[model samples]
Target: MNPLAKLDQLDLEPAAKTEVAALIQSLIEQAERDAKIIQAKDAVINAKDVKIAALTHELAYYKRIRFSTKSEALAPLQRDVFEETWNTDISAIEAEVEQLQDDQPCATVARPKRLRAGRQPLPPHLPRIEHRHEPEFCTCGQCGKDLVKIGEDISEQLDVEPAKFFVHRHIRPQYACRACETITAAPIPPAVIDGGMAAVGLLTWMLIGKFLDHLPLYRLEQIAARDGVSLSRSTLADWVGRLGVALQPLAERLAWHLRQRSSLHADETPVPQLDPGNGKTKKAYLWAYRSNDLQPGPKIIIFDYQAGRSGRHAQQFLQDWQGHLVVDDYGGYKALFAATRAHPETQYILESCIELACWAHARRKFFDLFQTSQSPVAQEALNRIAELYTNEAEGRDMTADARQRLRIEKSLPVLTNLHDWLQQTRLTAAPNSATAKAIDYSLKRWAALMRYAETGDLPIDNNPVENSIRPIALGKKNWLFAGSERAGQRAAVIQTLLGTAKLNGLDPAAWLKDTLEKLPAWPNNRIDELLPFAAPD
Candidate 1:
């Protein structure tokens, strides 16, 4: 400033003054260029710092996954510790960024906690056995006066009586006509398993025990021995086999009814099948198909057993059905959907069955990546998916039209944004990383995943069928494997009826007992009356 003032005071010639002004302008431009260089360097440094933080988080995530409890739930104290650490780290990063940008730190807001519910009371329907206790001394010690009767203290302790076995004597009185010499006796009521000592009650108990309770035949035989009733495993097996055959018609009816629906959920689980020839167990599939929740009918689940996990199994079972099929990203269903599209003229494709992909499957990919890598990209994808699920929850009980409208209004924009972000982010992601794979999987099934929003009748996932198949998964651990192909098929039949009965809120044992008693003389045309939902309350 002093040099410039001195120049002004110098009263120099015009050319000298112009030269000095040019020099000063050049210096100012150089300073501005230097400042720009520093800003660019800082930007690169900040980017690197973000990458380092993400990688550090990812490393810690992997370590926790490897060493921590498998349960996703955290104890209150553990959660507090985690939140404290996360907040401290986040605050530090925020402070650094604020310092770099010369900005104030934002205030932190804690999330509101949800209120816990009180203990629920026991059901009122159970029979009560009251016990009365009389005090020896009715007089109060301090007052020396008789205590007045006010109220009785009530407490309940549940008790159980061990299973009681009984026998039913079917008395058949025969009378001979004296003159005609003709003999006549009252006919015995028909049993589910004809000519077998096992009554309908015993058959129902065995079926319920094996299929619903997952008790193996040998275990049930042992249980029977404890009750002083010696039932051989072979006898139990015979009963089960006959019951399976008797219920075959009912299971077929259920399957037929399920296929008539406009939409269905399908899934499969592996069952080990004993191969006598190889002296080893072979893997077989138990396919479960469930009726749509929104469909106007009683919910039904049918399990089909197949020797292999082939698309043909599903195709054959679902033959002549044309509607939406919700399933996971199993390749076996691709052929079925393709056939539906190819043969629009065929009866199977008259309505052109649409393949609705499960959002759960898509979310699983990113979830797995997040669990393994804790990548910000994966987390962002998970957050977006969670929003879609939130929207689904809001529309869960809405009418079909209202639900579709809600999805179109709220979900469509999210999907569009997610699609764009995935496209842009994929370019920068490493080709071989878990995050990249998740992105690719979602983008590949983008059309199918997004299709759920188009119709309210379609569910977001195939969880109904998946849940239906869960019993088999649990049973497999105890039973190990099916004895043969026929045994596997029998299991499928029993499971189908039991599963459907449970879905309809009917007690499996009671339903089976009633159905077994009635199905023998029940009219063929009125078979639907025997369905679990149609049973008397």
Candidate 2:
């Protein structure tokens, strides 16, 4: 029954009852409003609690990183790839914590600044070019008398020559052989592209700027213009197209060498290709295959740009080549493994390819879970994975046999424990939970994950090729998309050569310039001599 209805039963006058009912209604409405406000406050508090937990976990991670041994930290390559994001994450977390605590007054504690290496002297080997600066007047301003020079204080500033342009004037004097009336001086020197205005050096600069430096041709044009040189975009495009054709042989040779390795790393990154018909872009793939670092040979990386990410692209690239291939759990590579071989009745006997799963991929799932939810299960998984990496680091520089022995002795035990833990954890974890998914991922690929421990030549992860793809991923921001499929393939050719050059520790620009100079006249029979891996004469 309504409380207001109870007034009817009370012994009171009509007006008195009406007044009492109004007061009761007002109080009830006020109580309802108060309940809603409290509910909202509770919701806000819940959100803050979740946010605080994530931030606290992040802070603890940073603290561990600060005090942890070098072997326990991320590898150098991974550090280089993630350093910027880590810094940004730290700042974002601090801001969020400050916002959450703004309403509450608390004692503030100052954090110690992280110790960092101070700026050291500039490289001593770089040639120093001197520039003298003199005052407008040699006389003192106050005293109208000439000032005597005592000494000069000099400080060095790091400087760069941004696309400095110069001209090479080739003057062929006409011979005064009136009898023959033949103006025969030295025949024009052999050129990479005869009659082209760009010298091999200039061509090299443009190639390096475009591919290695990740600058687009238009940007290269703007850079050249800054140096009072006018290089049209079309001309650059023309040069690039011709260079791709010229360097295709070298890229092919590098790919051949890459296949010779018994172990390899394969990975891919998506690239945007312009779709002229739709007035938009379509997805393309740049498949990167890198030779094993443990193998005794030059480091080779080949990029094969294709229209799509179908498994055929990889199959075609690795046709007749067989080795241990390290890759992520992408479905496209499923056909490459013998157990999952899509074509079992092929006429020719295909070489066997052993599939190796990347531990980093498996660990990344738990890493992300820990980051977002601070799950203790995920944290434990990460700790176990870290132990495996620590062992790998200890034997990083050892010979293949030694590394294999070290892994069997030190890493196999950890792997055994991790596998057992994963299996046990998965049984108890909820089927739909993130922890279960992470555990299942490792369990499904347990054999491949542990295979690296069985061989020293196999990498623990597909980081080598992934690291090579990083530059291309970064380049996509500037270049945007390839104009056509052909353009993308051409880009792959150039990137393969330049990337291979970088892997060999050669200055890409210098190697490219020398190669361009020799390529036009170099014999095809001896073409391998001009590859990026070859030592300069």
Task: Point out where model 1 deviates above 4 Å.
Answer: 1-118, 138-145, 175-184, 340-351, 534-537
Q: Quote each prediction's TM-score.
A: 0.76, 0.74
Cα lDDT tens digits, model 1, 1-537, are 645666777777989998997797788789889999989876766665565455446645644544464323353345545667765665564444444333312212222232347657667887888788988899998998999999988777778886678999988889999999999998878777778898888888888889888999988898889999999998999888888888899999988888889889989888999998999999999988999886678999988999999999998999878888998888999987776344646545333567888887788888777787688888899899889989988988899889999999989899999999999999998898787888998898889888888777789888778767766777887899999889999999989888898998888888889899998788889988888774444
Per-residue lDDT of model 2, residues 404-475, tens digit only? 999999899999998988888888999888888888888999998989999888899998888888888778
Q: List the residue pairs that clash in candidate 2.
A: none
Per-candidate Cα lDDT values, in order, are: 0.81, 0.85
Best-fitting candidate, scored by TM-score: 1
